[model samples]
Target: MRKNLLANVLDTPSEPRTDYARRGASRSMRMSIDEMAENAKRMIDGEVIVSLDPSLIDASFVSDRLTDDEVEFAQLKAAIEAHGQATPILVRPIENGRYMVVFGHRRLRAARELGRPVKAVVRQLEEIAHILAQGQENTARANLSFIEKALFAQKLLAMGQSKATIKSALTLDDTLLSRMLSVVETIPPPVLEAIGAARTVGRDRWEELKKLLAHPAKAALAAEVIQSDVFLSKEGAERFTHLCAQVKSGRRAARKPAEPERWSGEGIQARFRKSGKTFSLSLSSADAGEFGAYLAAQLGQLYDAFKKEKAR
Candidate 1:
């Protein structure tokens, strides 16, 4: 069944070429010979482009994007209004003559807002094929952020899809698939939704957040921060940054400063303080400067010895 679905997605017909000649009276509306040939090829391949009422189309079963960019959507609506839709969206038929979008969600949305028929290529696809087509199209476009892809993978997993199938759909390797799953699993859903497709936030930043949120207290703090009016007012990237900062600051404020350990031998005294992956050492003696320099110089050798001891 998976093989058949894979083949179906791979062998699906391409979007039909728009008929520029019939678009308008402007010179830009003239179809070049190349475009005409492309349209002829599409016809030969038995591809049909149809206009559907935007009201009849529904979103995909699993959403890939966290939130819509209203500014971008408005721009898309304007473009379609001024120049008409340049390319048709891909959709699969559902019950009662309704359709579910496979890709081209923005185009469908633009058409809907403009109160016009959406140009689309309808294909009959099973669940797996529908997911593959949608994932691959967005992956190719490179518009989805790392977190959005992770959320999509999470949704696919929730649907009982295998990791192999999810990886294939998103063109992700095993390591990346694991990382994506880990991130989604570690972060609270409400926080992720509130962040809303931090378009500028990449994997490293997300991983950092994941580690921070792994602690239940920090995760709870993040949830509270995201609900604040200050956090809500910020945009995508800002929201992510604000959440991270709030969580980190809360963790720091809640932690008590570690007491310093003091050691005295002969005329030398030493103090050491440790706090969450950072440590400080202070020495006071006649040879303190010389001893500190010696220790610094021996760090490499000491680290090697530490590793050897740890292995045992």
Candidate 2:
């Protein structure tokens, strides 16, 4: 990768990027580009004209925040100073003359940091609905965090969207939509924020963890289990959930006043299943005395009918 980038740096006529080999790269430094048409320029040198035509752009940034380290920001700024913006950023027009970045936030920030006018390839988005454009943009570029999407869906829902409309707005399937909404609805705010961290936890797995928190005590158990990476790994969280369920079951069993004789024939069969999600119960009773009175009443009625016939 270094050799190929270095070669591109040396071959391009615009300027030798002193920092290209070390600190930063052109947006063409993108590692993959499977979605583009064959003719799209995956790479270019300092000489390529990176222009921003307002007619060809849209507004809105998918990644609204930058990391604390700002390593990408520093590297991007250095690269922009040396090579200029080789690739124009994707953007859409906003309220003022300014445009909102659609995809290249790092590049845009870096350009500003370097005090260079950012170059961006503008695409006209007049016909596309805002939410659809946002969804399409997300779908095309990268995956979203489950929580990020959950929040997005909730925002859309609050904006008067029907369930179907919200699903369409996010371009998510029924199962995913249901799960996302479940997370938003169920997970407590602080715990949800902790799970939203980009490093250790994941949205799908974290959402499952939230379900375990439905019972307050179990929720506290989950909170303790998820406080650190060793405890929050998928395997760890699952085990903790299982343990929580087990303890809960034990507590419930202890709380029960024992089954009545009707269901006690088999004596309360209870066992956990393999998936830890299902259980079974079977009861058989042999008590003729429970029906003794009914049998006697029927016999008495028959005898009375017989006496009436005899009288007749």
Candidate 3:
């Protein structure tokens, strides 16, 4: 099922680009033929475009934006102002006939700013499909940075979408999804936002950051650094480096482990110990081996219950 969905996403049709001269499209509507064709094909395969009131559009579904690029945003605004909106955004209808954007935030922003009607394609989509369309569209455009994509994956999970749904949306395998989620879940949103997309940064560096932040003191320092003027002055990769340096500057030795927890009831006794993120459980006494075997056999059931608990 996921394979089919992914294939459909990859082959999604696009809207054909209208000729500027023929359509009286703005001179600012500058795009290569190949780009235009690709956009058109994608639109054709995806959905039909229609002009709608900008006031009726909402950006509430946006969860992946890391930062706003003023200059780039201005350029987009200018193009839209001059040529009118060329490409339509995707939207899902809401209650009372309102619509929420699934993607094309910049275009939506420009439309709102210009006080003109925005072009959009309205589709009925479930949460997973909505996110998948957003991710795949931005991916094809090479717009979303690594961290932004990671954050989007995190957002999907927070919304109670399963890991499998996230994988399908982002086109990530288990290993990559694990790495991405690790960074997004561990690093605070404010810190990630301050770092601002860090387009050149990759998984390894983010993994390093995740480890550095494992220390509460370093994590606190990082939180402070992200808000500092010095941190704000830097761009993308530099911003990430600056924060990393501050967090790594003075590391302390690891703390001693806490005493193992003890539990006893009836003829059973159990010991639980924690070291960092890992935990261990052990049984002792005459029936200890047999009890351990029983527990081990029930591990699958335990895990299923844990998953159900988490889902709730």
Best by TM-score: 1
Candidate 1 C-alpha lDDT tens digits along 189-275: 898888888888999999999999999989878877876778878999999888888888884323335689999999999999988
Per-model TM-score versus the true fold: 0.66, 0.45, 0.63
Q: How close is candidate 1 to the true structure, as a TM-score?
A: 0.66
User: Candidates 1 and 2: which is better by TM-score?
Assistant: 1
The residue ranges of model 2 lying beyond 4 angstroms of the native Cα positions read 1-86, 123-128, 161-170, 199-204, 217-312
Q: What lDDT does candidate 1 reach at residue 220?
A: 76
Instruction: Please estimate how well model 2 matches the true structure, expressed as its whole-model Cα lDDT.
Output: 0.56
Native RMSD of candidate 2 (Å):
22.0
Model 3 lDDT per residue over 136-225, tens place:
787777477778889888887888888887887777899999989889888887788778788889889999999988788888878777
Quote the positional error of residue 80 for candidate 2 in Å.
Answer: 4.5
Clashes of each: 0, 11, 12
TM-score of 2: 0.45
Q: What is the C-alpha RMSD of each candidate to the true structure, in Å?
A: 21.0, 22.0, 22.5
- lDDT at 227 for candidate 2? 55
Question: What stretches of model 1 exceed 4 Å from their correct place?
Answer: 1-46, 251-312
